[model samples]
Each structure stands twice: as structure tokens, then as C-alpha cells.
Target chain A: MSTATFPEETRARLEVDAKEIIGRYPRQRSALLPLLHLVQSEEGFVSAKGIAFCADQLGLTTAEVTAVATFYTMYKRRPTGDFHVGVCTNTLCAVMGGDEIFAALKDHLGVGNDETTEDGRVSLEHIECNAACDFAPVVMVNWEFFDNQTPESAKRLVDDLRLGRDVAPTRGPDRLCTWKEASRVLAGFSDGRGAEGTQAGEPSLTGLRLARERGWTAPDPDRLPVGDDPEGGAA
Target chain B: MSTGTTLTPVLSDNWDRPESFTLEGYRATGGYGALRTALGMEPDALVDLVKASGLRGRGGAGFPTGMKWGFLPKDNPNPRYLVVNADESEPGTCKDIPLLLANPHALVEGVAIASYAIRSSQAFIYVRGEVLHVIRRVRHAVEEAYAAGLLGKDVLGSGFDLDVVVHAGAGAYICGEETALLDSLEGYRGQPRLKPPFPAVAGLYASPTVVNNVESIASVPSIVANGAEWFTAMGTEKSAGFGFFSLSGHVTRPGQYEAPLGITLRELLDMAGGIRAGHRLKFWTPGGSSTPIFTDEHLDTPLDFESVGAAGSMLGTRALQIFDETTCVVRAAGRWIQFYAHESCGKCTPCREGNFWMVQVLDRIEHGEGTEADLDKLLDICDNLLGRSFCALGDGAASPVMSSIKYFRQEYIDHVERGGCPFDHAKSTVWGGTA
Candidate 1:
């Protein structure tokens, strides 16, 4: 029944950004998700104030805004860590040592799933498939990839983060920022740093490289292969 | 081991080129040529070309792509829309993410052509939130396309104004469903809506819409560039044209193997260097984990939709997750069930409750705590979940449970008989301790 409010300066800044996001959609209510991201960009978690702010911008009740916020797993209800470390434990990744990485990190970092460390540095959790199965046993830091990771390497990666050492994603932009900065970028505000990272990995290009090497292609009408369908003239 | 199937690189042809994600790189490779040709033709004619090409949806369900576009009513005064489902969350399915990351312009160009064919000015690409790098690449591609006059008002001086919005979803698997995606786009919880007025009738602000998969849309430019006969020349009769079969797990070389529809896993395994080093293939999915598991006996089975279905599995997403002999089938199936349980969305009781119950039983069985009745109980729960649930998510949850038990019921019994998993836990575990 109670709702918190943001500070005046933060509220004014979000209002300007909210208007731009709302303008992107024909209906104001549709801006709810991005607006939640915008608020999370300002505050690490989706606070009560953040929910109230989204409701105000989208002209919806707090309950409706809260429903959408709680539905998605990405929006943090509590304060998240400076570095959100997620190990993929989906079927492929788990079989490829993701389960091991997850269990190791839990003991190594002294935090369970979705729990941030006491130092407020790293929050570790088991994420679903990130669609990067080519780089199996993937570990993501602040939503950037640390691909083909081993448990030892992942342990060191988190330690480096907590110690304030510079860490880099295996396949991401040259620069690595905190989780908050990534959230801001997701809020539709361009940071002028786009497409400046590694594009594709070796695993992604394996099939393409093999195809070019063998000179193989879709069956050409002029020069079909020897085992062409007997009934086929052309498809 | 070779089945002699040639690798056909349709969508991934230019992926190796540097800056393939850039507009210049795309244009250099004859990227937007199809858009230029398609813009000059009647939109209906372009639709007919796709229909004649026998292009089917590549986002798990093998529905006809052109027929999906034709479902949009023409008389509606309200603006129609095109939503590209880039939320590639199906386990072991990795093609769309890499495709967008390596060559986003292909999809941007596809979006333009698709929107033009559907007579819509606005479109959206809904990408999953976890892959920030992919989202950034897609956003940059859209910006570059707009700056090049390939998007926005009067594209390429063809008088077809279009706008593309790249939206990011915040970690929910159910949003990959087309209806749930539309609902997520409309700023609601990503839950499937009731049918009767499907997405074609009312979607994304109550306007007629066509939701196509990322691969399905990206395949369009090539189809338009080449003739329908050219597109149809590669794949089978019903399932025509090439698709990306993502081969992952214990393979010596795992990646997206682009081939024609009817290519068998045996040939693909040969291309991928065959199941790690010396280990033999134990079980695999023709698609993602949502489909039933296939053993080495079915290695020669053609992977087209019809053939895969005939062999008792839907070609859902063409994600071939290969597991080797060292893997425990019961443990693997348990992990997949945990995924379904974690992502059930809790909208329908069958999916939500059935997944939770299945996870409990599967975990107990894997940990040497289950009795024989648990096996029957697992199947009974699967029976309740399949077909009785709201969406395919329920059926998908039941697939690995039922199929794994069908093939590897002995392994489940062994876990109980031996009082533990026979396979070394360290081989699969990171810390090498017991579960």
C-alpha cells in the first residue's frame, strides 16, 4: 500500500529519459520494461521508488508495473553486486562443465544463487542458456561473455573483480564497465561505444571455414552432385 | 563416417569476412541486392515467391513462412507489424545469436524486405537480454541502415518508409513463444494468450501482425535474390531450403553447421570431427533438449521436419546437442527438466506444477533416492503434462522425461540398484564432488 519516491534530481533526469522512451512506442504502457531498465540504471535494483516511477511514466497502477517487473528474472528486486557473474547451467553448458563452475563458485565466493558477496563486489547465479553454446561452459560478467571458461579460471576472474583488478570479457567491447553502466546502455541511451569489440569467435566460424575449404554449396542447377535425386529435374 | 552430404552455406556465407556486421561489408557481399529487387516487385508477388520457395519457419515450429505472412488481413485500416523472434533461448540452439552478432545487416535487410512485403512501416526485433554484445551489434546495424537511407522514410528512394526497433527482453524463456513475445513487447508478463484470434489477426497493439523467427527472416533476402527454384533446389520436397544445424557438446569441433534440410547427423558429426576424441555418441537431440532424445541408431535419420517427425521427434530449432558415452542419460535428462522447471512461467498449472513435480522426482532418481514406482510416477506425470497443458512448453517439458526413460530406463534403475550414479561425477562436475 505504500510507495517510495526518488530524489528530486534523479526524478527529473528519469522523466526526460522516460519521455524519449515513451515516444518510441505508440502506447505509453509499452515503455514499462525499458523504463524499468532506466530506473535500474539509476538505482542498481528495482526499488519501490523505481516501481512508482515506472507507474507514473506509463500511467499504470503500481500493481500492474510490479507485475511486469516481478515476471522477468533480469530485474533485480534487491541490490545487486558491482559484478553480476552468471554461469550457464542449461543442458549443453552443464554437460560441458557449467554445473561444476556453478558449484565451485558457490563455495569459492561464499554466496549461493542470486546472492551478492559481502564486499558488494560480485553476485553469482546460475543462468539459463545464453545462446552461446558454441563457447560451452560460458561465464558472463555484467552480461558480457567470458567464453570457454574453466572452474579455476572463473574463480580467478571473480577474485580479480572483488580485488578491483581490471577484467575483460573474452568476446566483448575493448572496455569493460560495471553492471550499472550496462543497464544504462540497455535503457536505450547510446554511450557512443558500439560495435567496437570482437565480433565472432573461432567456434562460430568453424562451419563457414570448412564450407569454403571444400568448395561445397547448395546444389547448382548447372552442376549438380553425382547423387542427385533421380526424380529431380530442379526443385 | 561420411554420408557425403555437401555443406551448403546460405545464411553464413559471408560470416567469415571482417566487418560482416557493418553496412559496407554487407553491401560488398551483395547483401541488400535482394531488397532492391524486392522493392521493384509487387509485394504480393514477393509473398508468392516465398510461398513457392517452400520456406518454413526456423524458430522451432516448422510452419510455412509465406503462409504466415499471408494470414495478415489486407483490409484492416490499422497499421500491420512484423516482429522478429530473436530470443534464442532453446537449449543448444546458438545459430541466431552468432548470426546477428556476425552479420546483423542480413537481419536488418531482412526486416526491411519483410515489412515492405507485409505493407507495414514499423517493425521490432525482440532479442534476449543476456547477450549484451549481440544486442549492441543489432542496434548498431539498425542505426547504420537508417543512416544509409535503407530504413526510415522512403527507403532507398522506393517510397516505402519503414522503422525498425530493437527491443531487449529481460531473461524469460516463455517470451520466445510468438504470442508471449507480442505480450512482452506490449509491456506485460510474457505469457501465452488464448487462440481464435491468433497473432495474424490481433498482435502488438491489436493490429494484424506476422511474427517470424530470426533465421526465417534472414533467409528471405537470399530467396528474393535467387529464384524460388533456386531456394527449393537445396532442401527436401516439403521442407525446402537450407537451415543452420547448431552442433554442440562433446564434439571435436562444435558450431553452427549450415546445410540443406535432409542432411543427417552422421554427416554433420563427421564435419564436426565426431564426438570429442574417442568416445562414441550415446544420445543426442535432433533439435534442442525440448525434443526427444535420439540414440546412435538414429544417426542416419534425415533431419528434415517430416523425416525427423516420422522418426519420432520434431525438428525444433535444429539444435543438435551431442552427448558421449561418459555422460549419464538420467543425469542429463534431470538437468533439462530443471531448465523447464526454472523457466515454466507459472501461467498454466500443468506446465508450472508438472515441471516442479518432474524436477523433484528426477532429482531424487539421480541422487539414488528414488524407488521403481518413481519411474512409473515420472511417466504418469509426463502423461498429465503432455497435451493437457496450455502451450508447447508443457509438451517440451515432458519430451526428455518420456524419451530418456524410454531409451535409458535401465540407467535409471542402475542408479537405484547401485545406490549412486555409476558414472564419475567429476567428469561432469566442475569441483568433482558428489551431488
Candidate 2:
């Protein structure tokens, strides 16, 4: 199969990026991972040509680039899609059922780890930690977040993205994060709940007092209520 | 005064207030005025101001920020890049993400100012991959700056162009290490490359680079708008400047506490509401969990780099992970070891294998399955990893491992002798079971 392609401009840019990556490493062979990332950004995989090009650009053998590319799971040595759904399966997320989300993606996308969709829309990569642990089972799609995801929400998101609908806001009915966890995360950083599994640390009066002292707080989010479920937290 | 009683000299003012995150609030409190001042001054003078302010890196190593900037070979004919390490994955470090969310402009302005000073056209904010919300907030702030003409070409008609790119990591703690962060920013597997090339001479794209912490860069605009002397007047002699301490674990306030350097934990706790009301402080990190642990006896020790170093530990990121009396030192150490094990990049043998082994020993001790010999063995393992590994992380991971044993050796022994954790039943209720 042909190596999955990216926007052509990305390919031209990867060359400069490739030289810089090679230039950073003392050993040319070490440039392989960076080269793979460059190609992935452009071609969506470290295709044979991509590997050969990187090897030639860095003055290393093709086998050299292939070695590091295959060694790390993040690099795809085959054709894949542009939009990658990264399911975080690290310990905390796993304990909170990140596995189910991974499974659901595999089932919904009809591809296992790293395999792309038939229409070349999305690929799945099982990752570790989406970082918002309190609202666990987070899947990062391209650069956007899909947190507290269940199979149903996962299906809806994939379907929406597949249909070319903007999944930007990432809220409303499909927003699976519980009211408490979602609000805490959206509310920037608060210690969430004292005894709950939420570990976002405590809030303070330094900023609270300064805002009040300077009269900078109230009119800012003028109409937004302080205790509202999910509004001012949106930046 | 930017000291106590609700004063914010620059970015962090009003962060405790409900709507302080809005652009309107940040604008009302003299936010972008620094950017205007920075735009007025020559980039060289801003660098001069920072150099005079004596600001140091807040990402553990505490390298002088101005000195680090000066390290870039100005006449070397290579494009310099400023990469902000927003990857706050250190075991007890929670300050940066909160800071970014609260005042993204602090970093955005810093990035803009640093990029101009360094003559870099592009800047990248490499955040912890896990902080999706924060990444979003920062990105939004960058967009806001660009819209306001604070970023991009000819900022406020200064005829200089800079682009700020907010990139997220795959959540590796190792990436916080300067060289590793560069590797990740360059879009690789996020491993630490060899140093001495040290991101100044040969960094991101084999050019001059500055890899600074979120707090370090965020502290810049103030030093720029306010004179260097104004910046210097707050803290002690060497470590002059305000700092953000991520006070977590058993602390009463348990959040990001921003204050000048040289403040004592007693003073900090007095500000933080004091040890969860009833509990007395037992163990804590003067910086993050990576630094050596400090006891209550050291409460009055100044938190500046010179003083902390005089007291035997570098004044690292100043992420104070406070543990009160009810918390078991062994369990806390065990939990920290688990984080190190999970975060160890596994590139070097000593950190990769050593952290895993320490976790196993610590796990056994935590679950009532350890022997007395294991305590010594734990110390032995940490000693090997301290300077043996490739990066500072191994050295950092070894710090807590060694200190927990140093100050609380008897605690480890007590856990082993009892065949279980001493505070399991007593303290589990405090955090409501997870401890």
C-alpha cells in the first residue's frame, strides 16, 4: 500500500525539520525517531521512502531509521490517517477503565492499535496518561480532549468527526465527564473534593484577594455566577 | 508591595478570585502594560534587566535565567529558539499548570519577550502531554495575544516578528529534563540527549536555544516592566525574585502559593493555613518530591537557592509537597517511588531498573511484605542511581529515595517490623482511603 499522505506542504517542511533533527544528534542513527516524527507529520507513517529519505538526509542506512521507528510504538512504519485518537492506558487511567475506551475505539474505528480507517480518516494509538486523571478515560483526538468517555460517547465523537462535523467545543450531551470532575478541570485548578478521588490541589485567597482588592474579578466574568456548574471555567 | 495582603505586581494578581482568568480581568489589573514596556525597550535591555534581577530557572536545576540567556552565542549566526518547559510532571509539582490556567498571558508575554531577546522568530511552549485543559487555555491565550498584535509580525509596530507554538508532550516526566524536552519538542520519543551542547549552543534544530520552566519565563515580564531592582528587592541576596510553591499533600492550603524566595516553610504554612488545622508537619520537599526531604526542624531555613544549597539541597523548583504527622513517611516514600518508576524514561539502566526495583521494595514495605534488610537495600539502590544515570532525573529520583531513608530510616524499619504500614488505618481516613 502507498504510504498515507499529509498536506503536501508538510512534506516540504519536514526536510528542514529532518536536517535539524539529524543536526541535533551526535550519532546520525539517533536522528531516526525525529525523522519518523517528521514523516508521520507529513506522510502519516515512516514509509519505505520516508525511511530511505531520512536515512539519506541524515547520511545513515535505511535499516537504521527503521530500527528506532519500529522500536517505539509512537512511530507508525506503515500507512495511516491524519486524525489520531490517542487512548491513554497508563496505570491511573487504566484503573479507571481506559482499556474500555481503547477497546471501544478499536471496535468503532475497526482498526487495532495504529491501524487506520478504510477511508483514511482516523488511526488509533494507545498512549499513557491524558493527564486529567480525576476525569479518567481521556482520549486525545489530534489536539482536542475527549474526557470521561464511554463507548457511547466515543461512538458519537468518532461518528461526528467522520461526518466532517466540527468536534471543537467537545461538550453538550456527548460530554461524558461528570458534573463535579468536569467543572473542577474546567475551573482551572482546584483541589476538586477533599476526600474524593479528585486530586486537583486546593485553591487560595492570594489571587482571590488580589482580584477583590483591585476590584478586577466581579465585572470580568460579569454575569457568570461563581458556583455555576460549567461556564467561567471556559477560557 | 507585591508581598502579602492581596498584591500582584504583574501576572498572578487576583488568581484566587473567581473570574480572574478572563482577559478583561487580566487587562484591568495592568496585565499587558509590561508587553508595551517590553516593546518600547531594546531587547538587549530586557535581557540586561533579567540578568540584573538574578532570576534563575525554576525547573529544578535553578540555572540563572539571565545567565542561561547570555549563554547563547549571540554572534554565532544561528537562529535561537526559546522553548518553555511547561511539563510539570515532578511528583509533587503542581504549580505550573495552575499558573498557566490562571494567567496564561504571564507565559505568553514571557515567551514573546524571551523570543524577542533571543532573536528567535518562533517559540514553543512544550507542556505536559497530560494537561489537555491547560494546553487549551494556553493556546487560547496565545490566540488572544496574536489577535491583540502581541504575537506575530511587527508586534504593536515594533518591526519584529515572533510566533508562539503551544505543543503538548506524551506525558513523560523525563521530558522536563532540558535536553529530553528539546528532543520531545522536536517531535521524537522524548529521551534526553547528551548535555554540554546544553540547549544553548546546539538545541532545537541544532541552533541556539533556551529551555526554561513555566514559572521561570512567567516571572520575566515583571522584571522587565518593573526595574531589576524592584524585582531583586523581594527575596534574599542570590535567589532574588518571586516564586510559586506547589504546596500539596497534607498542607492546610494545599495549592500553588506564590511568594518571594527566602520565605520559610513556617511563614509559608502561616500563609497556607497551617498543616490541615490539627496535624503537625513531619516531612516535606523544599522543592518538588525530587529534592531531598526536609523536616519541621528545618522550617525556618530560607527557601532561596543560596540558603537551600547551604542547607545541603539545591532550591529546586520550590514545589513543596508537605506531609503532616498523620501521614506515614514510608507510605509517602513508596508512593513517590511508584511515580518515579512510572516516570523513569528507561533510557539509562540505573534510573530505569533502579526505580523499578525501589518501587518493588517500597511496595513490599507498604503492603506489610518487607524485611529489615530491604531498607538498606533501598538506600543502596538509590546510591547507584544518583550520579550513575544519564540525566538529572536519575539524580532527582535518587534524592527522595536517599532522604526518606536519611531522615526517616526508622520509619522504614518500623513498617517492616510491623509487617505493614503504621499509618494505614490511622491516616487512610485522612485522604479517605487512597494513602
Candidate 3:
């Protein structure tokens, strides 16, 4: 339970965004997940004020909001660094040097898992799979991928962030946003970077390149076998 | 490297282009043609075509897609919904996130077509919240579809209306299970509900709903565009159509290989340039971490649903997590069990408690402080956990443990005798050296 509350103007502005999000779902309660993200965007974490605002907006109790927020790993109860650097330590990533990257990062940054640096520039954590396994030993800064990472590369990434140097993810946006801005995007508000980076990464296109190289393509649908169920009613 | 089965890229065809995620890029490749063709026909006819195609769900469970759509009662009093499960959090299951990032329009178009077929007026794409870029790509695709008159309000002048909402899920792997997904979408803690009435009967606001994997839904557009025969012609008789075979870890060229379903791992490994230099294949997972791990001996087994099942593993999401001999089986299984223990949702006792204890036993074994009786104790714990949980998470937790021990019990014994992990951890790393 947090005693802090958002300023009056801040609460008023957040209300507008909350209402817009509430309208997206059929029922207002269904907007809780995004609403949590919206509040996270406002305060960098879901504070007591954020929970109270959500409870009021959705007509739910604070306990209900807290339960939902706590269930998710993304919503932080305390302040987070501007850039949250997560190293994927799942099975595949671990065997492929994710453990090394994570250990090196902790030592380099002088912080343990889920702890922020003294300057509040970066927070370190060992994340589960973020689904970019082909680019194993992956790192994520503010939910943007830094694929195919090694301990050395991961170190340079955090140092750049700490020094306020420009750092871009392996895929997606040309520029990286702070943690709060990323949360806003997750809450369904676009930062207009939706079409920023290349649509596909190199590994993602391996199959397409192989198919092209081998001159393999799906059979033409127009030349399909006849005398069968036209509507495919084999069920 | 020449195998009888060659690659057939449909969903992943345009991924190489820089603009593959954009509407302009997708339209150039005849992307929305399926939705246009599907919109003109009766909904029942569209469902029939899907049934004829024999397209199974690309999510871990190999349920027939058309059969899942047909389960809705004819006279549903409430609105029907199509919830796309884009939460690809399974360790080593990495296809859906990349698919969304590369070609989100495919899923958007498929959502339009499937929602119309199921008579759903509203649909939602529940993506995992961790991938911000993916969520943006998919949301942009939905926005583009709506702006192009393909999604909202009498779509393409066919008098059928649909609304697509892209919902980002807060982190929970259990939400990948469909029922838990609906609960999460409804703003509740993402825990699985008892399944007397499946999602088809009563789901998502207590109405008829069809939950589908992102890949299964994305594959719909091609099925509509190409016809059932075109799909059925590619793969085996039962496991029809092409799917993404995601190869990751310890391979010469790891990536997504979209090929016909029945292609074998032996053929795939050859195409992927075989294991890394100076390394031979050891153990691997045929699917994601949830499925049983397979050794090099099973490489020739057909990578289809039935054949993989016959070989005692599953073609789960076609996520082939390859590990070479340099990797430690005990360490791999221990890491995967920690994931399950961390993600077990605590809604059920067996999964909540069983995973906790299994982690302790495996950690002890991995550290070379266990007797041989501890291995049996681990198996005994797995027996209690398997088939007893409310969801598949427990069964999945048991998979790597039982399979790794079965294949590498001698290795476990070696760890005990050597008093620690035998393989040099630094050797398995990317740089292959200690800092």
C-alpha cells in the first residue's frame, strides 16, 4: 500500500487516457491490464495512487487491482530505472551464454537481480523467454530487443545507457525510449514508431531465403486436384 | 542436404522484404485476397474449406482448426469472440513473436476472416506484454486494416462487421493456455478455469468463443487464398499444410524454417549446416521445452504431429531447441524446471508444490550433492505432478526432467561421481572463454 498520490493535473490527464482504453474493451473491467500499463507509464510503476485511480475508473476495489497488478511480472511496485536491461536466462539462452551475460552485467553494474543502479540509469534482471530464441543470448532494454548478445556487447550497451549515449535495439525502433514511454506504448498508445525499423530480422528470413535459393514454392492453388470436396467438406 | 521435402514458405514468404510488416508490402503479395474471397462466401462454406484443409492448431496442442471453429452453438444469445493467443512465452518457443514482428498483417487478415467465419463481431489479439515492438507492429497492422476498410463496419461492403483489438498481456506464461487467456483478457489474474464447458461452449464473457494460436490464425489467410488442396498437398495425410520450424541454439545456422509438416530433423539439420563447427548433436527438444527432449537417434523421425508423437515427443510449435554434446543435460533440465517453478500460477496444488520440490532436487543433483536415490525421488515427484494439474504447465514441467533423466541418467551419475557438472560451462558459451 503506497501513501503517495498523483498530482491533481496528472490524475486528470490520466483519466482521459484511461477512459479511452476503457472504451476499447466491451466491459470496463477488461481494461485492467492496459490500465495498469497506463498508470505504470505515468509514475514508472504502479503506485497506490495508480491503484486507487484504476479501482475508481473500473469500479473495483483496491485489493482487486493490487491482485491483478501483482500477478503480472511487468507491473513494478517500486521505481524502476529509465532503462530496464533484461537478460534472457531461460534454458536455450542459458546454454548459449545468457548466464554469462547476466553474471557479467551484475558484476559490471554492481547490482544484483532486479536492482537498479545508483544513478537510476539501468535496472538489471534475468528474464524468462522473450521468444527471440533464434537470436539466443538475448538482452532487452526497455522491452526492445538487443539480439545475439555476448557479455562484452551487453556491457557496452549498459555503459552507453548510463553515459546517455544513443543506443538502438537490434530490431524495431531506430531509437530507444525510456521505460515509461515503452509502458505507454504497451498501454495501446502508439509513439508513432510502429514502422520505424525493418519488419523482419535476419534470422527470421532464413526459411524464405532457403526456399528462394532452392526454387521451392507452394503449389499453385488454381491447379488443384478436382473431383474432390470443393468447399473442403471432409469434416 | 537434398531431402525429398523442400521448404514451402507461405506465411513467412514476404518476411525478407524490409516492409513486410506494412500494408503496402503485404498487399503487393496478394495478402488480403483471402479475406476478399472469404468475405464473398457463406461463413459455413469458409469453415468447410478449413476443415477440408486439415490444418491443425500451430499452438502446442494439435487440435483441428476447423473443428474448433465449428463448436459454437447455432443459437448463441451473446456475442462470439475470437481471441488470438500471441503470448509466445514457452522457453524455446519463439516462432509467434517473430511472425508478428515480420508479418503482422497476415494475422490481422486471418483474424478478420476467422472472426467472420465464427460469426464473431469482436476479436482480440492477446500478445505478451514483454515484446513492445511486436505489440506495436500488430497494433499498427490492426489500425491499417481498419483504415483500409478491411476490418471495421460492413467490411468490404459485405454487410459483415468486425472490430479487432490488440490487447497486451502482463507477463504470465500460463496465459498461453486458452482458458487462462480469457481470464486475463477479462482483467482477472491469469489462472486457468475448470473446463467442463470448453471455450467453444462458454468462454470470454460467458459466450461462445474460439481461441486460436497466432500461427494458426495467420495460416488462415493462405488457406483461404490457396484452397484446401493446396494446403493438404504439402504435408502428410493427417498433418496437413506447412508450418514454421523454429531452429534455435547450438546450430550452425539457427532460424525459422517454414517447411511442410512431415520434414525430418535429419533433413533440417543438414539444411541448417549441421551442429556448430567441431561439435556433434547430443540431445534436443523436438518442440519447445514443454515437449520431451530427443537425442540424435531420433533425428530421422518425421517432424509431424503423429510421427513425433509416435517417437514419444511432440511437434510442439515446431520449436526445435538443439543442444550439442558440449551442453550439460543436468544443467539444461535444471534451468527449464526453474522456469516452470517460477511460472506455475499456484492455482493448483500439484503444479505449485511439485515444481518447487523438483527444483530443489534437480539443483542438488546438478551440484553433485545427491545420491542415486534422489534421481528416483525426482521421478517420483514427476509422477505425482504429471497428469494431475489443472493445466498443462505441470505436464510441461515434467517433460524435460523425465526425458533428460531417461536419456542422460549416466550423465547424472557422472555428475555425482565427478562431484560437479562435468562439461566446462565456458566451452558451451558463445565466446568459448572466460572473461
For residue B351, model 1's alpha carbon misses the true position, in angstroms, by 1.0
For residues A1-235, could you state the per-residue lDDT of candidate 1 as single tens digits? 7658999998998899999998888777778888888988888989999999999887799999999999999999999999999999887788789988899999999999999999999999999988888889899998998988988999999999999998878777876788888888777777666678777788888988899899987666455455645356553
| Interface DockQ of each model | 0.63, 0.08, 0.69
Top candidate when judged by DockQ against the true structure? 3
| Candidate maximizing TM-score | 3
Q: Is candidate 2 or candidate 3 better by TM-score?
A: 3
Q: Report chain B TM per candidate.
A: 0.97, 0.93, 0.98
The worst-scoring run of ten residues by lDDT in candidate 1 chain B lies at B426-435
* B109-191: candidate 3 lDDT, tens digit per residue: 99999999999999999999999999999988999999999999999999999999999998999999999999999999999
Per-residue accuracy of model 2 over A1-235 as CA lDDT, tens digit each: 3343434675566566666655643345444544555555545555777776676676766665565455444455566565667776643344334566778789877898867789777777777543333234467775345656666677787787677775642311122232223222322222222111111223533433433555532112123224432221432
Model 1: lDDT of residue B262: 91
lDDT of 3 by residue, A1-235 (tens): 6566679999899999999999999988999999999999988889899999899899998999999999999999889999999999998999899999999999999999999999999999999999999999899999999999999999999999999998889987999999999999999999989888877778888878888998988877888666664444653
Q: DockQ ranking from best to worst?
A: 3, 1, 2
Q: Give lDDT per model, in order.
A: 0.88, 0.66, 0.91
Task: Name the docking class for model 2.
Answer: incorrect
